[model samples]
Target: MHRGRLFRPTVFIIISCILFLQGLSAAPPLQTGSFIRDAEIEATLHEYITPLFRVAKLDPKSLNLYVIVNPEINASASIRYSIFINTGLLLESKTPEQVIGVLAHETGHIAGGHISRTEGAMGKATLAAMAAMALGTAAAIASNSSDAAMASILGGMSMAQGIVFHYSRGQEGTADSSGVHYLDDLKWSSRGLLEFMQMLEKQEYLSPDQQDVYMRTHPFSRDRVDFLKQHLKNSPYANNRLPQDFYEKYDRMIAKLSAYLEPPGKTLLTYRATDQSVKARYARAIAFYRENNFPEASKQLDGLIHEFPRDPYFHEIKGQFMFEQGRLDDALTSYKQAIEIKPDAPLIHLAYAQTLIEKNQPKMDKEAIHELRNVLKDEEENSFAWRLLAIAYGRGGNLGMSSLALAEEALANDKPKIALTQSKRSQYHLKSGPDKLRAADIQSLAERLVKEKE
Candidate 1:
């Protein structure tokens, strides 16, 4: 949905409140860190987790999977069936199976309702700690000994840990058992889980602070590794190997991530011409694009498309490159080819819509609006698409719809004040129908946020 940028790295944390419990004034904010919305990576991950979701009796479509641009080896499930995986974990994993195993563990947390239950427990402890800290600080001000005052503050903080640590450990154990079951049901080996834990076992030698973020969050133990090993011994698919295509997709995912995240020189050096593997060539092509060597980039991509004619991702990347180079007609052709190959890819549709808008022909504006609306039907949270929809509506002279789109875009981008303004503007132009009602609702929410700030 993002326009004019291949990789839009968000600068701020996205805070969303999902209210689960009844009669609560406020719920804890689910902080989804900066996300990368690469079409190929997202499509590959969706394929990988679909079977796990089915095994766990959970609906995959209801879950929002976010890839955090963190280098930490960690993943977590939040209360709203949201799974967050670090890019570092994906990059560091030696194989797709390792990443899948981690995903299984996180899915276990969601299926078991551990995130909500743990949040309830943690919430109580956090409130108690906050109260204690206030009381402790007051006592410290009244006390003469500074050392004794500091001890009092630390004691209050440790009390919160006491309330949550044991419960967290139990949840970890449950998730581990459930994850193994999910893997077993899907006829996949549990060895990957054990191997990941074995890596964690080495972290045991380090102090808690020195351990990897995964160890700190997931709380790995020798007993958990032993459990996985025992399960693998009895599993029918203990020695099963994943399909070669899965490995190729994994390689492509890693190559794309590295080419985008690392320096161009580093990518080129790592993926040398001597290594003519598809992934290596793909990475080198991206590196060339980053260095603005358009001819080399296009030549490499054209070769790839010739070899893998039906690969929608290659076409998507080609479209992106052409768009960046201001070759509008060529970009449109590539985007249409990608959409034809992968009709269900929302990101491709979004990219095509962006290209249509850029073309700026009167007829293309309507088509752009149609494409943007199609994407929003499946991806309502995409702020970039909403923004583009606003622009398209404006170009078509539908000021009411344009203002409404802007309002929604502002809300999605966490700008409540702008949303309020746009909503009011929309109400002035829109008829007294569902659209006006929706505008009123947005106005109310934005007003609430403004009042809270005041």
Candidate 2:
């Protein structure tokens, strides 16, 4: 079966190593761990956060949200309005409100300019400490040496403590107040924030090293919860309820994440026959798919499509299953339907293009090139799409375009030397036009990067 380089862990690891060696001259790309990308989940999160952003007087469109695959219950805000949320938090949250509450708190950090202020104070020292901690964490996982890991982390923290503006308790209080104000403005309850804080309260007894990353970064206090409680008691929207569909979407997001991340056997055991809800069935379908139970997987997916006929994501999942199972024609059909339902989703377009390239028919290759170019119009940074575009161009006998696409892919993947070579090669084949000018630009960038490395 032709694999279209989806979530290639090795590539990510290599990119991470390259970035580490290069040093943080610019903000290192967001390489925190495996990232989970799905159009539906992203849309849901956008819906959840847009109102909060508006309430906070921030532009919703400017914020970038990333769903990390880690199972830790943590969220962080970084430069450029980037917010990272862990899948574990979504799976563990009891209600949509709870997840929103966490997001609100993180948004509080963004609106209050906490991340930038902290970074300014710590400067390069903070980056160095983070690198040391990352190395220590990797060593701990590789060698199972908790003592060594703890020593490294504590050493890094200690070294940076003098310069780091470790958010004062007063800052935490301000964030809490800001979050509550956003919730109130949106006519949503602050109960979720209170409940989440109370849950973290149980971790107070644990040693600093034993605490989750959230508690480590956020620095919880009873007074923070009490302060929230006091405001919640007087807030006009204390008892408001989220929409019913909100719960359904939230449940499905959790189920999907659990199915994809957990062991197939474990997922199947957790979502049993008795629980016939849509989300449960979806999880079972994915678990069965992963286990290679093709018949059962198709059966569950068909049932979902039958029930929610217009849900584009269900169709997308079915397409993914068919593609993995080597049913190219059927997969193409399913992907087409999904795109028809949600034509604007770049991810769906990428998937469809990938399947088309894997099919490898000359006509399909041409179509895949068209689709990929369209995708690049909106998602220019997508290296996988660029890689597939290269494949498509090569298959269609467009050597110049193929070389240019390869250069773009290498650049996106941070292989400046490879990009430089490809860009130079493309210049030999490409005619004088916009494409050649673009190739020249890439060649210049690649040369600059190589010089920096030297």
Candidate 3:
């Protein structure tokens, strides 16, 4: 299968090397992956929304956008002229109009100049107090990751409260009105935004975790919803409606994402479910899975697979689970089935490649080098692949080729992965020849070259 293991490890190796490899990264080190890929979504939003901002007298360039991956429902604009979005928010939003509305509101924060003024206000009045608190914050700097995050969050909240001037709820009100106006000017529908707000307002009654985070942070009150309704009443922009083509694209994107991210038995939640009851089940299944309810996850996966046996994605997820359980043969079979069903997905290739490397050492050593060579043919600057290929070469008894690759990795990233790949060469000066004689010869050569230059 496309994403399954290339081979099952012998029983002994499974107990030894497989366990050792998994142990190599027990505590997921700080995953500092690039946030650039999601920028495509931001760029698309910008292209469609910039004109609206222009008409509203906001500089599109000055507004810095940050897309963060936090599962929690939250958005903030205290320090940077930025919009930090959660992927969950994007997935859950019912429409593009609502997404644009949220952006408009954040833009309102920047245009309103909230965070800067607040900080400046504090600095002016209590330079001493702020300094003391800043120092106190240093106490939180003691090397615990959780403590540091809390300290930073507390620090930001503290400075925000005393020093920064927040645009009052009235300001939020004015922005809401202006934001809709901009949306209306752009001839985008306000229904989506209103619908989203109503959803949040209703959600306020539900458990905070069950509802979108917007309600909790945005400070929902009956007044805010009522006020929006009042403004939207007799409004020209209220008719901003989604086109049929837009729905088709939106549905397609949601389907692709659901197929990609959902585990087995997940009833696809693509802005709609087959039924409200089924949708609730889907959401609950996801919560259970996310909360580490593996039995529940398995149960849910089984249920969904039973319901939709024809769906290849479900089997793909089953393969993932089996792979995790060390059922290499089963995973391989499932992944192969998935590959037959969906051959074009790049992620499938990545998964298959990873599994292949994990299972068959001899095949992996040969295939990895071959793949890297082919990849280097197109893009020679791929230092990471080069490093891997170097290791493969070392495994193949090509020491010189391995060293050359190691040098490239070190030069490109300044951090060779580990000593396992002749890591000592990068670290210490080495020679099989007598070190004393080599040192003296190098010293003599240097002296002669230096004297000639002089």
For lDDT, the strongest prediction is: 2
Residue-by-residue lDDT tens digits, candidate 3, 1-454: 1111112111100000000001111112111110212212344555545765686687665444444333444454543344555555667777777776776666666566654344435434233212111211112213324345233323322222222233566666666777777776777766666766787776777886686555655666677678678767867768657555455344433443343244424534432344433334344444344445658657766686678676555556556566555676777676666667765432333334445544648777676565555545433433444555565666777675566565544323222232223333422444454433433333343344334335
Between candidates 1 and 3, name the one with more favorable lDDT. 1
Writing each residue's lDDT as its tens digit, candidate 2 over 176-254 gives 8899889988899999999889888999999987876778777789999899889889988999998788888898888
Candidate 3 stretches with Cα past 4 Å from truth are 1-36, 78-80, 116-168, 205-212, 242-249, 264-454
Best-performing candidate as measured by TM-score: 2
lDDT of each candidate versus the true structure = 0.72, 0.73, 0.47
Clash statistics: count for each candidate: 0, 0, 10
Q: Lowest summed lDDT over 10 consecutive residues: which window, candidate 2? A: 16-25
TM-score of the candidate numbered 1?
Answer: 0.81
Which order, best to worst by lDDT?
A: 2, 1, 3
Please give the distance, in angstroms, between residue 100's alpha carbon in candidate 2 and its true position after superposition: 0.5
* Residue lDDT tens for model 1, 1-454: 2222112112221222111110011111111233456778888898888899999999888777767556667777764466778778888888888988888888888898886435556556433323222211122224534344334433433343332222276788899899989988888877777788888889888998888677776777778888888888888999987767889999999998878766778999999989989999899888888787878888888999999999999999988787766687999999999999999988789888878887778799899999988887777656667777887888888899899988886666456799899999999999999889989988988887677547
